[model samples]
Target chain A: MKKKILVIGAGSDVAQALSRLRAERGHILWLTARSQEALQPLLADLKVRYQVEALGFVYDAELHSAEDLMAQLPGIPDEVHVAMGYLGNPDRLDDPKDAARILKVNFSAAVLLMNAVMHAMIEKQVKGVLVGISSVAGERGRKSNFLYGAAKAGFSTYLDGLRNAGFSHGIHVMTVKPGFIRSKMTAGLPLPGPLTASPQQVASAIIKGMKKGRGTVYVLPVWSLIMLLIRNIPDVVFKRLNL
Target chain B: MGTPMSALTKISNWGNYPRIEADVRPWPLQTESPQIARGMGRCYGDSALSTHIVDTRSLNHFLDFDAESGLLTVEAGLTFDEILQVCVPRGWFLPVTPGTRFVTAGGALASDVHGKNHHAEGSFSDHVRWFDLLTASGEICRCSRTENTELFYLTLGGMGLTGIIKALAFYLKPIETAYIRQHTLRCENLDETMAGLEAYGHWTNSVAWLDCMAGGRAFGRSILMLGESAKQSELTQAQSLNPLKVHSTKGIPFPIDMPSFTLNRFTVQAFNQVYFHKHPKGSRDSVVHYEPFYYPLDKVLGWNRIYGKRGFTQYQLVIPHADARKGLQEVLELLAKRKMSSFLTVLKIFGEQSENYLRFPKAGFTLTLDFGISASLWPFLNELDGVVERYGGRLYLTKDVRMNPDFFRRTYPMAQEFMEKIKALDPTGKFQSLQSQRLGIHA
Candidate 1:
């Protein structure tokens, strides 16, 4: 049976990649991004290339309340994927406005958007999955991107709590932690080739996590071990090294 | 939830030149219309390039088939290789295909690609029955020769500006064997090669490997290959093992981009010299799998990287039969005079005319010259475009990158009508590719 999946940020390459794999097996997709003008071509392309029903909406997650955004969707999605993230230039955090903007987009906006989806699923008694794509950077606080990492850490903790709450309600919550993906976010960075995974590789893990009903997942299973090693380091020792 | 995980990265087509920083999103199976469709990025130029591209490689799927009627329905993203994998085992094959099977159905239809057997089998446009096109307005318009007839013509080689093709149904050629019986002839000079090609024009499939480096009286030395689909009785022992199975060549990838100087004129000239001498004035008849017969270059996986990081451009032009000899002579002379050498040189004859607008073939002889991308390539190609324009021929859009609007309009007689048709389908002018923008097609 095809699952009615709603992708909150269809413009993201990870969401697009995940949908590409699932839709081929007859998954129904509902796409909502910041702009229909930008995501519409993707919907049209998917409909043509996969011959699947891909509906897209111009949804501004930051601007609209979750309930208002829910009104735009047709029904309670069987699966909801919140794959939106924001990382402001680390060097440009001189102004308080930049800090607020990043926090609003990354943390507050995501919670508002997913809360509406959670309420709708509970109302409809939908027994399905809620997936969120976080980053492995959230595992530890580093000076280079500690703020963005803090926001993701907060979201990961929120998902862990959501997983506990959803377990009693017949809903599953999965938090995806992708490390050093070769995406637009890390396009030009001189990251180690062996350590980096492509969006497709990350997307595949997300799907696996959903199917297995796992609470949290690292994109490449190897990243899980790497994160474990990083997490066990004492703060006194970890703070000395620039990550 | 909104996903902002899209990463912008630099990607290029097969030529590996003109790499651009593009926001490559995965193909959203369900969403609004994407700006452009990019298949395997097999096109040698900017024709398939876009800053914001919907990757079509993931959409690849073989949907339906009818062995009795030889009708195959496939998603636009399905590659020729996938199609052949299924159909060849069922005694069916694509009626028309390009030199490489890596191309997706949508890419082939968009370019109206032709094969070595073009004189007999024609182009992809001729074999297609109909296709489901997702327009800019997000409507799935069923297009065919009889239905939505206007768009049908324009979309055939329309460069995909009409819409994103969703699915297409086409007729396939049924075969009893997967082998092609070929007869090879070695020609001593330009006149002999042309004469040999003419003699084999009626063969089911034929092509020539010309040594463009040959100068003076020894010019146009070539090996002319002529073939016909092997009958059941003519199948070789290896082919009969699994008559319908598709054969795959062992691929050794070019691990890294070769240095630009690796394939310079001196190297190409020497290579051509060796190739020219390899085959003397003789003939050989052999039976082989259809894969190698149609897609010889496919044997060399990632061979384009041999041209180095700048990539290469394939300049293909077809001139009227009347001017073929002189035009070819001039083309070769220009290359030799400028010391511009081509690593891969091909010559063939096109038959009849296509009803579809923007189709490149006519009753003429065609030549393909492959030049590794270099700093001086544009000016050299511009002069060659002048040569083509003077002789009344046009470039293949599939491999073109630098042709100007004036030359395009002059060479293709149906440019105005084609533009009008594209505008009719795309009234809001939504779809635009790098090639269309460069040629001022949208304006």
Candidate 2:
């Protein structure tokens, strides 16, 4: 059956891959990004390559209210993928503004958007799937990126609560914990090659998870075990060793 | 969404030679002079290498397409692999494609890459309608045959020295199916191979795999493969049902670099002998998927690792038709005498050259040989360059890493003109590459 899919942060690498995959499956796409200029090309590409309707909406998480953003959509979509994220320089935490921006973009704004989308789905009686892309860094805090991790940890928890609340309402919520994605957010980092997943891998995994109604997904299954080990490490030993 | 952070990273081209540290950033950053745009880093040598690299992979996006006319517009960073996935199912195919589908549209244009069908379709630039180039002055200039005519021709094989190619419009050949009707001819020697290629000139695509290690009478023994895009009517029942199915083979990755000693002369000779005898005698015809027909090597991801950590260089040269036989013979004989082994050797015939200033192909025969890097390889290649120059041949800049300025000037002839034009366009010597600097092509 054909479906309507909404992808927030459409200019992101993972969002682009996910949108392309969904478009290939003959789904109608509503993509939102901060810059319509960046989203226009992707929208045009999807329409041409898949011969599907693809519309674009300019959305900035910091500036736009959740209700206003949701109201701009044509109607309730069959699926909503929240892929927005911010990984500001951890070293710049000395500046409170940077720290606050990271937390708001990753956690607060995501929660508000997902909440609005969930209510819209329920009010319209649409048994749709909602996917939130969190990170493995949320599994446990690390010295290198704890601020970003704390925000993602909050987002992951929020999705867990949403999954419980929406189950009765026939809404499926999924949280994706992707480890070391080779994307713009992690571009400069020296990510472990074997552990890192390409945006396509993450996108495919998310699609599979949505179909299975899995509450949480690790893009690479190994990431589950890796996160387990990191989460279990003794506090003293982990603090002594630099990651 | 936001701009990806730039990083100082260690990078190398497909050949993995002359590895260098470069400031690599996503595309469309503020204009920076002396920066080179790199896509997939598929070019075999220093042509794509520079201190600062504008990574164009993120710019991959389809801008427009006309299903009826087969006119397609796409961002420069779009790869042929991505194009085939979308277009093939719609019965459209690239007008001209290099051996590997991993090449980017921009890279293909800058290199003016030729394919087995060059004798029939010319080079990549011939099918291009126009392109938007981000000039050194940060202005987006639309270049085509009529508009920005001089810049258009100069940029086409300009080695990305003219500016960064942002987007392009080109025509795709409409095909009935995704399969190719292939015919293979086994030739016993150089003369037979040349005759076979000439005999099969009517085919849309023709190329030969040479046994470069063969000596004496067996020299240049090859298998000539000819192909014509298979029509729906030509496919078997099973294929005709899904005649437009695109290639979906996820190639196996080459996990680790083979030890340097694994690619020695003895091993290469044995592999060549086995490969030569694997095919039956005389001519054989079969319908094959375009994947295997056009890109057999792409099946082994990072196959260049076979050359080991020291890396290798591909020496590709073309000699005018009149001197092709002699030039090829001399080059092969020299390699044999030197006891140098090239694991992969290819030969093709090219048709009329384009007016594009620096495009590599001309009315000629071209040969490509890959040699692993070694201390003696440089001097040996220099000697081979002399033989090529004597035969009025020129080396492919896309595959070259160490051709001296004098040799480059003598062979390309239009190097000075290209430099002068680029100078007028980029007066501050912006958009220079290691190759341009090495060959004195910059202002």
Candidate 3:
């Protein structure tokens, strides 16, 4: 059976990978972004390449309520990929508007959409899967970008709780904690090979993970091991270390 | 009636994994509460981890006994010590005993645990005459091969997923004494070791302790050990002296976690080499204590701390009888490459088809190894899971800590069948555990 997948925040690189992978699966896809024009070329290329149903829509995730936006969807897609994120600068968050914008965009927006999707899922009474892109930064706070880290942390915790709720209901919620992905999100930063992943790698992982129904995964796979070591760092010495 | 307190459920072997947090309520103590059955806390993992534990340890009450018929009835929580305490003195023994005696009558049937003698005796399920189960709706169910056969099969190796076993009626074997006439052979490699095992194919009880430390030329080197109760004619003056007077001090408990690096290649290699050479290679008549003979590791309490706070996981998988040889070779090779040394590695030959399709041991070769949690262990286990799947084998859920849901479903094709039965009995999915929730078993 063919699947119809909807990708939110389709202008981002991770969104590009999500759209491309779903297109390859020959799925019916609806890619959404702030401006339909920004997503048009990719949607056209996807339709031409995979020959599946493809379309683009302009939707601002931060401004719209999930129920209102969900009603606008052509139909409930086979799967929903939420890739919206805001890796805003933590050091320059003096402005109340900037801080709240980041919080609403990264945390509030995704939760709203998830809540609506979950209700739709329960009503439909069908087994479904959801994947959210979280960051290793969310695992624990570091000095580098904790504002972004804290937001991912909150989002990841929310997803965890959601997964617990959906588990018995046959709906799977996965939280993908990518350690360091070389996307627009981390273009200039130096990343170790084993600890880092590419957008394509992350996309492949998500696709494989969803098919496997794995509820949680570390994109690089090695991060679980690295994180194990990090978790054991004694508080006495951990507080003194300079990262 | 309202849902039973979340605290009142009992869980079994397949239920503990990923280490999640939850409230486990004890079984109700009221007169109306259903009678409980306690199993050996070691159904490998969670098979016995539940609320309302029968504490079979106290139920050690013995009922009717027919010495000539080898049929006996005992409470569900009785320990092997208590059983052996009473029965062995009367020249009678359990028909089937798994590796560990720490198990109870309820657990043995719940897991349908097999032993070195599996090829001959099948499993504990095959020995059970009948049992009493406390169903979810608060009913006492008497099930057996002739009665509620479906429930009977479901409870056997059913992981206690069916209902709580309250008591068991099983047949016992007549033995002369507690001593076992034993033999041991040292095999050079995996092939030689399996060859030694197959040579003793008809022995009453047989198992092999492998030296996983040996790699390449000598990997899977092991001591092929076989034994059975000594005949009256074979007992010497000293051996027949006193059967019930066995004595040994309990093992000292570990006070603190060992350093993670304490078990590096050098340390483990030395231990394995020393242990391998210490056991003499000859047929000898020696009176051995049951604890050392069977539960040797049980001597060291709190052994998990040996891996430090990061406990180790035992990855036990069995390749089908057809691909047993080649598959085990590749698996051991992978473990060597990963340098994941276990405290103890074991190899056993199982019997023909088991009653429980999803059960771990089958008509094949089973290998178990303890692995300390490492940064590289997940990917390594994932790779091993793939290999096991390709060979039409599955990881034992009791010991699994890393296998994902997809891998689990593929390996156990009969899973849907098992799940169907469970849902009918537990439509609301009231009883749950970390492993069941993680692997989607409850659904």
Q: Per-residue CA lDDT of candidate 2, range B1-443, in tens?
A: 12245567999999999899988777766346478999989999899988888889998899999988899999999999999998999999999999999999999999998899999999999999999999887899999999999999999988999899999999999999999999998999999998888888999999999999988888999989999999888899999889998887599999999898888889999999999999889999999999999989899899999889999999999999898999999999999899899999999999998888886888889999999999999999999999999999998989999999999888887887887888888888778788888988863
- CA lDDT of each candidate? 0.81, 0.90, 0.71
What DockQ was computed for model 2? 0.36
B1-443: candidate 3 lDDT, tens digit per residue: 01122332223332122232223322322233222343445644443443333344434345456667888776566565556655676777778876666667777777676777877777787888998887766677898888988777777777666666767889988877777777777887899889887888888878898998897778888888887777766666776686533324466787788887887778888999998888776444554544466656556765557777555677888888899898998888887888767767888888876656466677888888777777787888888887888888887775665678788778877777877887887666544444555677763
lDDT of 3 at B57: 42
Query: 1 or 2: which has the higher lDDT?
Result: 2
Q: Judged by lDDT against the true structure, how good is candidate 3?
A: 0.71
Clashes of each: 20, 0, 12
Cα lDDT tens digits, model 1, B13-120, are 887767888766655423342256788888888887765777666555555666678888777888998778767877888898888998999889888989888888
For model 3, what is the error of residue B48's alpha carbon versus the real structure, in angstroms, after optimal superposition?
4.5
Candidate 3 TM-score versus the reference? 0.59
Question: For model 2, what is the alpha-carbon lDDT of residue B363?
Answer: 86
Give each prediction's root-mean-square deviation over alpha carbons: 7.6, 2.7, 24.4
User: Taking chain A by itself, what TM-score does each prediction score?
Assistant: 0.95, 0.97, 0.93
Q: Sort by DockQ, best first: what order?
A: 2, 1, 3
True-vs-predicted CA distance for residue B431, candidate 3, Å: 3.3
Docking class of 3: incorrect
Q: Is candidate 2 or candidate 3 better by lDDT?
A: 2
